[model samples]
Target: MSKKSKSFFSHFTIAHKITMMYGGIFSLSLLIISFFVLVNVTVIEQNNIKAEMKKTVENIDDYIKNGGELSQETLEALLENKYIEVNVVDVKNHKVYKNSVGKLPSFVRQIQSQPPHGFLDEERNNRSEELEKKGFKVDIAKEFNMDDKAYFISSRDGKEFVLLEKEINFEESCYLVQAFKMLQKNDYYFRSFGLRLFLIDILGIFLSFLIGRYISRKMLKPVEEIQQTAERISIEDLSQRIDTSGPDDEMKELAETFNSMISRLENSFQKQNQFISDASHELRTPISVIQGYANLINRWGKSDPTVLEESIQSILAETEHMSQLIKKLLFLAKSDQNRIPVQKEQFCLNELVKEVVKEMEITTETKRNIIIKEQKTVEIYADSSMIKQLLWIHCENALKYTKQNDSITFHIYEQCEYGCVDVQDNGAGMNEEDVTRIFDRFYRADKSRNKEIPGTGLGLSIAKWIAESNDGKISVESELEKGTIFHNAFPLKKKKNQKYS
Candidate 1:
């Protein structure tokens, strides 16, 4: 087959393919059945013809033995039953009786008049000897043809006419020669039967095709509906959902799965749009502040040292803030895309926590009492730098929220096979709602506090990302005005056994 033909066949609809398959199978099965039936009928008819011919020959033999001549009644009975034509031939190869063509030649009486035991006993012996010498294997009964007429010769009791009786004694031996000719005449029976069977097969094939088409259509109806629903839905219009109402079959499951996928896509698209909008708003503020300060420096701020120094510092601060915000946003984008390269190693959680506390105390101008409590050597498998960053974010948040002289305690220990670090501060804590969304990007607990503190709200979000990338979890516990505690937990690394350290 050519590729074009193959492609054409492949393009056939499911219903067409099913219809063709069903039609082919049904037509083949019907043809096989019809063939067997016709063959069996032919065999049965042939057997019956052979059996009736033998019976008629036997009956004629018995009548002649009782000194009764061949009667018209026997001839009429055989003719009425449509049996084979019969011919009785003597040992001299002379026909004694022929039913269809009337009496035939019989020269036995003239050849030997009262010479031997009966009419043709001597001739019978001579014929048998000749047949055996010629490898004929002469039997008591045999079938032969002469002049297009069939005869059954039977030899019996070594009598004159016993050769005729022996051959025709069994019902299976004798049959009408014209019976084969007559059977040929009824060839129309086969033709008619074949025509009827062909018609039936054609009808059956047509019905099978119809049924297959109907079933395919019914089965694929749900799939077509799903296709239509999907075609109507686009990225801009993801609100369209397939509403399936049926038993929990495969079709119903497919529809439900499709709906679930659409719902996820819609949520992701919404989040992406929101993130872009939030990023624009956050970046716009720093740019506007820098622009305003640049304007101030240009407008007579260059003449005054104080104005020049203040505008320059303010512009630098705002630029730095914008740079930090952009870096955080880029990091989050890489994290979301699963492109963050994490190199994990074994590190002590307690040591990292102590270092972060010391660094915070040195860097900040505030006199807050930072204390390390419950510090222990708890080893964990994670990216050490990312874990340190996570700890610093939490410590910075504590310092930012707390006033000078406020106490912030750091705890590092192992609990339940997990290395845990906790940063607790006596700072302005959050309500239940703020605690819930504390890790959300660009989410500030109090807008007024944000102005006073002058800090980007992306710290906790970045901190959460760092902890999760290191296979750790971050959680917060806080009450309004009672300060807040941020806990980070990681699975403790198992120690490998060694023969020598």
Candidate 2:
């Protein structure tokens, strides 16, 4: 087939394809049934005709046995009652007796003169040779016989007859031949039945095609709706969703899955737009500050030592802040893209927590008291640097929120086969709503805290990412105006062949 033909077939709608398939199946089924029915009916009628002819032959044989002479009246009465004709032929091929109702055809009369004992075999061989001479092939293995009688079917002037012959012991050597006309009424009935069946088959195929089309349309309605919904959806408006209110079938499941996909795409688009806006806003302020300080130094800072020093320090601080923000953003982007590589090793949770607390105490400017409440040697499998960064972020947040005289405590312990660390602070705590969203990127609970404390809001988000990447969990418990506790938990590593001293 050509490509154009294939393309044309492919372009057919589902309903059209289903209709064609159903029509073909229905038509084939009808054809097989009709063919079998016709063949079976014809076989039954032929058997009935042959059986009746056999009975007539038997009756004639009994008459000759009883020494009753077959007269014209007897033959006429037999014809009226049984629709049979009889003929008697002698060995010399002479007609001894025949019914007055009808005369035997010439072909049947000629066959009747043959002897009865091996008559069937002889006739079959002779017919085969005759057909072969006329350039027609014949299967000599195929022979026709009924009981002990030799029979042949013949058609004369468009009328069909079954001729059967049986030998009887008469005073003279004679054979009884019976002829039964193939019933014209049966032919008429078959023709009428065939016409009706053809009409019914045609009607059935039409109805089945229509029903198939309807079912296909109903099945594909959901797909059509999905296509329309997709056509209306755009990047700017991804809020369009498929309706899934129906029975729990494949179509309903498909619609639900499509709706879920649309929801994910919408969330991704919103986040992308929000990230771009936030990044621009954060960078704009730092760039403006750096430019302002540069202008100040250019104008008068060279001659004035105090102005020069202040401007230089301010520019460096702003530049450093921008650099740190960019680095955090890049780290978050890598983490989001699942590109952050982690190198995990066995580390002591107790010593790591103590080290972080000591370092915070030395570096923090506030006069807050920081201490380790509980410590135990607990080994964990995790990325050590990421764990240290998580602890530092928690301690830094504690210091930023607490007052000068407030106390912050670090606790290290083992719980439920997990190495655990808790950073508790007596600081200005947050409410339930703030605690829920505290780890969202760039979300500050106290907006003024971003200004009062020189820090970025991405610290907690990055801390949460680090903890999760190391197969750890970070949870927070805080009450309004009360202290807050941040818990970091990692699965403990079991040591084999080595015991902790």
Candidate 3:
């Protein structure tokens, strides 16, 4: 057989095997039963014939035993029963004692005309002869073919023998022969029964296969959805989620895992991109300053000592900027590795904001002029150092983007259960687009123009982490000329137990 056909048969399913077994058993049982019934019907017909023959023998035997010759009354009764003929002969006198004759059928006449011999015994003798050739003397009389019909013989007075002969139609043999012939007449009848069963079995198997395939597809539908979901995902489209609508099965769990992996991957990618952008921007600034100062020194140092000294100062300044940028980069890398230890505690947010503003005034360019607009005390539960870092980023960002002499404002207050802080800048305000992406690491609104500023894009990203790490959120609102407002909210701090020291 071809490979495909071989494979199909080899992989035949449980249902196919079941159907074949059922049909095979049913067909086999039917064949066996039909054979037994045919044999039984033939035997019954043979017994009926034998019984009639025996009844005739009894009538003839009674008449002879009564010390009377074959009487006219007995002979008349035998003749009246149609399809029968009888003759009794006296062997000593060689004369016919009694004869009752009727117009017998040809077949019956043929049976009687045959030489007087035991019909069943003679057939058994023939069968014994056949068996003897095969080296076995089988008890042939008990055989089904031999016992189906019978004949008998008797002697009168042991010497003056009277031979009485009677025969019946071979009804069983004739009926069986006719039946066998009829069964052979139409090949389609017998063959079609089995053929139709086979066809039905095949159809049942095919339908079951279709149902199994459909169920398999339904069971695996979630896997298919996961595949399509995975296919749809790219770095830009990682935010997409699986469309789950069924019971929470393993497939749903798989979909959930897939979505989680995408989310994590997207976050990592964003952080990496942010790191690269910040590093490039931060490194470029100092390099540019160093180059400009070096060029200036080369051109004018020898001509003027004051110019040479000023160049040295400028170089020192650029070197300091580079060092600070490197330190921030290192800090960010450590944080990415989760190496930054958190010291959690209940701390005053108002005090933290005040400290941040004081530091900014001391260190930044648009410094002491910035006003603190906070009116109320705010406190929260968080890591103190991390929250301070968050405050520094917001303040520094506000200071950097604002023009010289523009005032910065800080407002601290309570909103519902949250401690809210707002830092407003009155300098170069941002647009909606800038507000949306300002927190991305290393992202600057004026990419080309901000090259002079030694700012790493990671500042706001770090600030965002600090806020979220403590179950808080940061937001921004801005208009092009009206300036920008950076908002931060922290959960309320729980009361700490006072320890007696």
Task: Give the alpha carbon lDDT tens digit for every residue of 367-430 in model 2.
Answer: 9887786656789888888899889889889988889989898888888867998999989999
lDDT of 1 by residue, 435-454 (tens): 99989989989888778786
Candidate 3 at residue 417, lDDT?
74
Tens digit per residue, CA lDDT, model 3, 1-501: 999988877787644555555555655665565556544644554454444444555555454455435444555564423333444433222334333343321112122333343543454335434433544323322222322322221112121111223322232221100000001212454456556656665665566556655655677678778878888888777777787677888878888888788889988988788777768876887799789888888998878889889989989988987787787788878878888776667788888888888887778754435777666777777788888988888887777777787778888888877788888887677777878898876678766656666576767878887887776889988887678888988877643462310
Residue 149, model 3: Cα distance from true site in angstroms: 35
Query: Which residue ranges in model 3 land beyond 4 Å of their true spot?
Result: 1-249, 259-263, 270-274, 281-285, 288-307, 364-370, 403-405, 447-454, 494-501
RMSD for each of the candidates: 9.5, 8.5, 15.5
How much lDDT does each candidate structure score? Answer: 0.70, 0.75, 0.62
**Residue pairs with backbone overlap in model 3:** 442-457
Model 1, position 102: C-alpha lDDT score: 28
TM-scores of all models? 0.68, 0.67, 0.47
Of candidates 2 and 1, the better by lDDT: 2
Q: Model 2 segments beyond 4 Å from truth?
A: 1-17, 43-186, 342-346, 365-368, 373-375, 403-405, 493-501
> Clash number for every model?
9, 0, 1
lDDT of 3: 0.62
Candidate 1 backbone clash number: 9
